[model samples]
Target: MRNETYMWKILAKTEPEKTLYEHTLDVLTVLKEMMKIFPDVPKLINEPNFWDYVFYALFLHDFGKSAKGFQESLRLGKRWGYRHEIISAGFVACLEYESEIKKLIALGIASHHKEIDELKSKYSTHRKNSPGYERYTKALREIEENFGELVEMMKLIPDLSEEFIGKKLTNFKIPNSLDELLDVFSFAVKSYEDSKSSGIDRVVWLKHVFMRGFVLGCDYLASSGNLEIPLLKNEISEIIRFEKFTDVQLKMQSEDMKNKDIILVAPTGYGKTEASLFWVEKNQNDRRTKRVFYILPYTASINDMFKRFVRYFGEDLVGMKHHRAGYFIYQSFRDREYTPDEAKKFANAFVDLSKKIYKQFKIITHFQLLREIFGLPGFEMGISEMAGGIVILDEVHSYDARVIGLLIEALKILKYEFGARISVMSATFPKFLCEVFKRELEIETFITAEEEVLRKISRHKINLINDSILNGVDRIKKFLEDGKRVLVVCNTVKKAQEIYNVLKEFARGESKLIHSRFALIDRERIEKSLKNESVQILVGTQAIEVSLDIDFDVLFTDVAPIDRLVQRFGRVNRRGRLNYADVFIFTGYLDDDLKIYDKELLDRTISELLKVQRINEVDILNLIESVYADGFTQKQSKIFNETRESFLRLRKEIYPMLSNKIADEDLHRLIGSIEIVPSCYENDYLKMRESGNYFEVVKFFMSLAYPQFFKLHRNGQIYQHSHTLFCLAGYDKELGLLVDEFETNILE
Candidate 1:
């Protein structure tokens, strides 16, 4: 017979040899902390006994690791072919709870590691008289031998109810065959499907959602060594009390703004960041907010805000998520002088922690949150984490029409379904667009900088140049020689590279080029280099519009829509520290420029530019209104409505227990981007991957648009190995991706 404490000897983690009992304790510790932060989690499903279910699920989640085959695999450091969760879930049948409660607990435990379909696919063949029945029976017998010891160990948990501990856990029937064990899984799935179809079972559905989401949250947090969720420090309020608020910011923080949706229209330099924080401070003080998400459009802006927030609020209170968030976190750690090994360790850990539910504040790209509505894997946790939270959407006008439509629908669900408060901010928000948001979000407060304040700020004098911006190299060089920092914006990456190559020839001071194609590691270096006052000439595409915060003496750019052009203009003499900066618009362009921006919009932009010699801050709204007067084109409007309608249907199809594989595929497809390694880094990528240096492997990846990816792939320019794609496309340290086939082919 096995010893009384034999169950405690089962290993949950191998590297450190932590026993099952110890791991359960760690997870329960996290549960206690999370309950303090979110006491209403039980009330979310109208089930007062929800906490008890969570405890039962966590206790039985890993007992199947005691199977002889699983133990040998762990000891030998070999792959375990079968999932332990399947057998662990069989323990639910031994509980004396009601049938419905037992099904909920079983589903939560079984699906914690794998989604519903995946769990079924892996074990469907293991029924009675099946190929794997004998093996399944053997594992069950092993678990039965240790069941008594497991219950003895459970008696140690102080959080477990006294009645539960006193019950005869052995009296409940143990599965004598594979068919009986499979019944538990079958019942759970049947109940889940029934709940999805019945309107009356909506509460049942929500109960399962919190059950699965919180179970996964606590399990992952504990397994990763983060045994507690960090509490939100009252840091935002302290900053608001100490820092002086600008006129626009003061309006955003007014007492009436509490418990209301907000629309804030402010110019670029009007302290929108501070205003949003103050709004958050007011909301935090007024209600019980779970978490706060500050959403941005571009990764550059997200990274900048992540660093700024970490500085203001301690690093422990702030976290970030994006495609290359791991790289940014790794870089931030290295900046603090951590050794490469240490940085890599902490970066990997924090990446897991940030994506989970530990941090109080999350700075993320819109795509990160959009994945939740799309019902991607682990989306239940995403929804649970943001329930009763505050969502701050900055630069609301930056996304395309399709994304704008998605946001409207997602925000509706977040507000009415999940109880999240939203605050939208934009520099160039038009009245028509504001009306759309106001109707959808039910915005209560409309805050804008006073016209007098805008009139007092004069930053740029717009000038129209007859020749192409490419022909203005001489003018740019002269500015560099005169100790003036020059900014050059182009419509296409090819154009930017061409102009940068020309400028580097005769320019006197440091010059740099930025676009969308460089690897994140190299891009960070280029952006950091821009901080030097000596970098005289900076050239880029539309990427420069919102990606950087710097003042230039002059600007030369191709014609674009007036709103985008205004964003570009904001980069020059940004603070009005200089009397006025000159912005020269080039009239000449090739046919390729039309492919980037709409010809109609470009024409309207030129027509508007012809009328104004200087862009005054106060009159900028009128200029934007004139250009976007028609709102989205008919075709763009169709795309928006179609995307919005289809996404709403998709949301309805998603339930708590099952994971939609199509939804995951749709997310990647909609993102329209893929990460790839340039051929130059193939050797380094392989070496790092082999050495288990995943952080180093991540550094070599750069995002490429799907169009470019498909084009290169069809031409035999890309290949995949070990789940990573390697591209033969050429890359330059200063010029970014070399898209010319001639150049890329030469590298091949």
Candidate 2:
């Protein structure tokens, strides 16, 4: 059996090592998630040559962890650290190579975590002669001294050797010679010329540093046995069967969402994930040219979706991004060339895995989305990796304006530039979103099965009772009296708190309140609270809207935007139940701020329903679509632009204060400049951010359960309150970031 543990012998206490470990785990976790998206990879590993090099690169990428200064940094956990990575590079320096293969591997390993300079700077030689010539020499020496005697011990498969020797590979150097450069280009980054890039060719794609990365990744995941992989396989079929989608759905409604960009606004509980699967299945093999980017609004939702995919596809096909817990990606193990100093060659495994999926097919959430839309310094390689995939935005309607703007731009790139497809699905979508997609996209379509679709699929009644706050309280009371599990949903956080407090007086024991205010653990505990049969009433804001697999009977919601109202309705009578309870939308009383948002949504809903002048057309989905068709026009384009611009302006307005310790007096000037009066990071919020990309960072914030508020910015940065941004500057928290407690500027 291949050894799974990847422990650097002389390293335990050091800051750099810890950071490296974190980085290693983050990379591996993304790879392991391959199972969630493409579970058949392990089976591919059964091939001897392919598996060996992949494992070799993964295992030794961080061999520099054994150095003393690296140990001291971890022990002290300080800012300044020694160059133990160089010490690890020394292992590769001792190697004896036919030319410089061993040294190239070492240079790849040494430069994994940190940015490397030119060979000329380090070796005092001609940088023009070799891009990574300095470190490559060191790597070659390490192979001879540190791992020379162990050559016999390392797995030496013939096919693997042939594959490597046949291809002349170099590191970080684009040869000046046109012929050599073209050869380099062909070895890497070529598209679709060979979609069947499994086995030997796959290993070649990730041989050096990328291989070292896969082992480190697998090891980190192995350390945390408690890590949970979402089980979406079983849930998908159940979701489809329970909702009873028509046979015609197997062949996606072409006109509704043909070969065009689209945003789907069907009610919640409408078999969306499965619909994606149907699309995938129909286009399978043919659409292997692209993968699927599953974009979710929350980590909890992502987890749920991950599990759904795992259950459906199994471990080999998926890749996960569990941003809240800890960062890790998984890949299979194998053995090969070992040089102590020649580590750090595995940093590109995520990029490599993404390439595999793009060549094959995959299902990922924000991992690729954030990268695809936004550029990263080292991993520009991922852009091509995301080549063969459709970008699916689930719960997009739940996004704020900034997120909406980001999606519009990103989808535009995927659609027009990349020739990729985009499908935005949510139970609720407003007129603004419809206008955003219909007008902005090159070729667009809209598929809203709304209430009519929901009703047709599985019978349910939408009993819109009295529109009053007292009615909301009354509805909860009645549901409890009826001995049914009730789900109460409100629009804003403040309103949710007030109604919950009042309902507490009328309700018995075992009622639960959940919202954006609580920490992630608290929210999870609250979610767990629902599992008990004794729990009767569940009340919250939009936080409990969808992505959760909770079952409830009756639903009471305050007057909300039409799409949100539909989403809340989805929470009830989801799985075929006759005698459905009433769905009351209380619309009378509203605060000034909410009045503008709420009335606009409600006015559109009511106006549309009145046009037909019949109860039959009151189906919320129809009401929502009518609002879009009637309300959206060239005139409405200005609102989309204004909303997007203002959100970005607000982000820029408040971002500066986050980094800077500003004078209190300037706070007013800062706030005044904000177009939307951007909200500040939570007052009391600090938690260890498990390292991951922007999505995980955001999810970790939501997981903090501290009333954490984050905005998925149009720049692909998800800003939230965390100990990480302050220290790492990942979310741009640095000097002069904050004007005061709540003011700063975003450099658009």
- Best by the TM-score measure: 1
True-structure lDDT of candidate 1: 0.78
Model 1, span 1-748: residue lDDT tens: 1123443667788776878877877777777666666666666667776877877888788978877677778789786677788788877776668888888998999889878777776565335767455555666666655555566665554434332222223324444443455444456765565666663355676677788888899898888888856665554656556456689777766777778889888899788988888888777733333688999999889988998888787788888988778877777788899998899889988888788888889998888888887778888887778867889999876787778888888888778667788989999987778888899989968888888878887889988888888898888788777778888999899999999998877667788999888876678789889888778888988888896987888899988888888999988898888889999899787788886677887888788878887667777888888887887767667988898888877767777768775554467667667888877777778888998877667778888877888888888888888888887777887887786642344333
Best by lDDT: 1
Q: Which residue pairs overlap in candidate 1's backbone?
A: none
Q: What is the lDDT of residue 139 in candidate 2?
A: 35
Q: What does candidate 2's lDDT look like per residue over 453-545, in tens digits? A: 455554344545446565567656866776778778776655666676677666555777877555343455677667786767777777777
Model 2 spans with C-alpha error above 4 angstroms: 1-113, 116-248, 253-267, 286-290, 325-368, 415-419, 428-435, 444-479, 482-484, 592-599, 606-618, 629-748
Poorest 10 consecutive residues of model 2 by lDDT? 727-736
lDDT at position 639, candidate 1: 80
